[model samples]
Target: MTIVVAYADTPPGHAAVTAAVAESRGGEAVVIVPAVRDERVPDVAELEGRWPELAGRVEVERGDLGDPSDTVIQVSQRLDARLVVLGLRARTPVGKLVFGSTAQRILLDATCPVLAVKPSVAGP
Candidate 1:
């Protein structure tokens, strides 16, 4: 089964990739990162450093797709993915009322199942 991860240079995106990889143990996990237009986004170094840990499980694709949420689902569809995974940031009621969450948008539009991962931590 093919699983797709939507990655941005954000904590949520990082966690999304991690969750994607974990769930894709016996499947293919593809990471989709948008290419910057004029300004560049930092490269995902973890993709290389963690190669040994991922090896055949992960594949990276770069594209300057116009719509991030749409692009993510499109890539998943193109790959015939069984799942599309993305991280979600908890938003306040006001925030959600003003602007919907990416995960919510994706969940509503994705053709396949979508996994919304939220980071849960304790202590400091």
Candidate 2:
């Protein structure tokens, strides 16, 4: 089965792709680019360039500029993916309450198992 990845162009997004590559273990990765404020999405060329190891097997799907949580959940269910991989960053309790989290929604709603990972920190 293919592994579904929630991809973006930020640090967390890059981290998610890396984590997905490691988890795929030579399997295919269905990368979904959830819409951002700018409407910029990552094409195959970008994804391949950023992740050479997963070049051929990476399939990118662009979502509409809407609720990211909905896109992720829908795609995961439709693909019947083995797992849904996403990058997670730490957030304060107040921040979470103020602005609802897409990651939290995905974790609670995805049909397949969700794998949330944080980027590794560099030593000072």
Candidate 3:
């Protein structure tokens, strides 16, 4: 099974992608970009440009538009992924309370083990 990665093109997303690549060790690394209803899908080229290392190493799947957590879960199940990797970003209590937490939902709902990583303070 492949390793599923949830990417948003953010710092935390970058961290997750990097971690997944390292963990893949030449295995499959499937990158899933979540798309909410009516929201435009992220540009794959831009993403690849931002992270050159992913060009040949990662397989990106910009799934149908929907809630991020749902998209991640669905992709993982469809792929029968062994693991789901996600990036965690620091958020204020109020922000989390108001915005709700995609990470929280993914963690609680995913069938396989989920790996959550934060950007290293030392920098990339």
Best by TM-score: 2
Instruction: Report each candidate's C-alpha RMSD, comma-separated, in the order given.
Output: 3.1, 1.8, 3.0
lDDT of 1 by residue, 23-74 (tens): 7756465664542223233344657455345555566665446766767777
For every model shown, what is its TM-score relative to the native structure? 0.77, 0.89, 0.79
For model 3, the run of ten residues with the poorest summed lDDT: 33-42
Candidate 2 local lDDT, 25-98, one digit each (tens): 66566565562434456787877887788777888665553787778777777778899988888899999999
Give the Å error, residue 90, model 1: 1.7
Candidate 1 ranges beyond 4 A from true positions? 34-45
- On lDDT, who's better, 2 or 3? 2
Between candidates 2 and 3, name the one with more favorable TM-score.
Answer: 2
Candidate 1 lDDT: 0.68
Against the hidden true structure, what lDDT does model 3 obtain? 0.76
Candidate 3 lDDT over residue span 60-115, tens digit each? 67566368788888888888988899999999999999999989988999999999
Worst window of 10 by summed lDDT in candidate 1: 34-43
What candidate 3 gets wrong by more than 4 Å, as runs, is: 35-57
**Candidate ranking (lDDT, best to worst):** 2, 3, 1
